[model samples]
Target: MAENLNPSRNMCSTNLSLLLILLISSPRPAISRTRVQFLPGFDGPLPFQLETGYYLFSYYWANDNDVRKALNVRKGSIGEWLRCNKSIPYTTEVASSLEYHLNLTTKGYRALVYSGDHDMIVPFMGTQAWIRSLNFSIVDDWRPWLVEGQVTGYTRTYANNLTFATVKGAGHIAPEFKPMECFDMFYRWISYSPL
Candidate 1:
């Protein structure tokens, strides 16, 4: 419980800790995905600012200012992809983009990409669209586990060796929305990592 109650000034650190927890736990975690909510809303770099809530609910959080600063919240709608990577290229970029990801994923490395179904910040549908474009395939129609309840859903690509999951009642902030499942997924993904 204490671990779940961290303030936003600690959000980034919290993320780092989560990565660590996923690594340390026994039985191993099945999935791990990081949160990116427009730090500076544009800087696309570390040392991101902390000021306003990234979105509507941010105002309701105890660490609103820290969230805003660390998240780099800017004034604009996230219509499609957020372009969060600072190092991604423009030309032959698709080739450059997700290459490290593909490299790690293809060596039988497991990847878990879960989105909060209610998260407009990075919608599940959009994440799926991005996953679809990656075109990772040793085979096709690879499947993953999913619960029919409102809490979660998952789709897998055996061809690409990537799994896309959805948390039903959660929003843009997943651990905040459903910590139990978040930890569950995180623990699983971390167990057998190339990390």
Candidate 2:
């Protein structure tokens, strides 16, 4: 779904999506709860990539419009997403407020943050600002690991049970960039079998 996201273009949107994804996706943790965060640098724009800003700007700008596309969509998607999503109307304030609650107010939740060095939407550096401020518990040393070759980065497990990772070369769409690696991470996090 997130194909055009550049690493350095839409830090705000990218970081927001990554944050929400970590909070929202149904967890199947055989081990424990985990949250994965994506990094987007601070300042005006992202690092190397430049299209992210435009993508976010356009998304917000046209968030309310019907925006009729000429392509065919799966049946249920049109009813729930295309038509309904536009109806609910998610404003920047709403988005930000949700983030605050998920990141700070929620209880007993764990997160695993990851980023792609090549992503332009949320540059790795920009993502660090908020993450550094998190004051989360860190019990493990950050280490380099590869999922799919393109989805390789760092892993930091927190004392309270959060696990953060950075996927190599992935942008907003980490799965597309490195499906195997993403799966590996998930499987490991959800390791229900005896280790």
Q: Which candidate leads in lDDT? A: 1
Q: Write the per-residue lDDT of candidate 2 for residues 1-195, one digit (tens) a residue.
A: 233234355333434444334434525222211222223343353333321322233333233122212133333453422212446756564534446635543475655566666668788776665565566656777777754444267876655455667777667657646666777777776772100
Cα shift from native, residue 115, model 1 (Å): 0.7
Error at 37, model 2, angstroms = 28
lDDT of 1 by residue, 22-79 (tens): 3345252222243434432233554443222333222223233344444555434222
The whole-model lDDT of each prediction reads 0.52, 0.50
lDDT of 2: 0.50
For model 1, the run of ten residues with the poorest summed lDDT: 50-59
Q: State how far residue 119 of model 1 sits from its true place (Å).
A: 1.0
> Relative to the unseen true structure, what is the C-alpha lDDT of residue 20 in candidate 2, on a scale of 0 to 100?
39
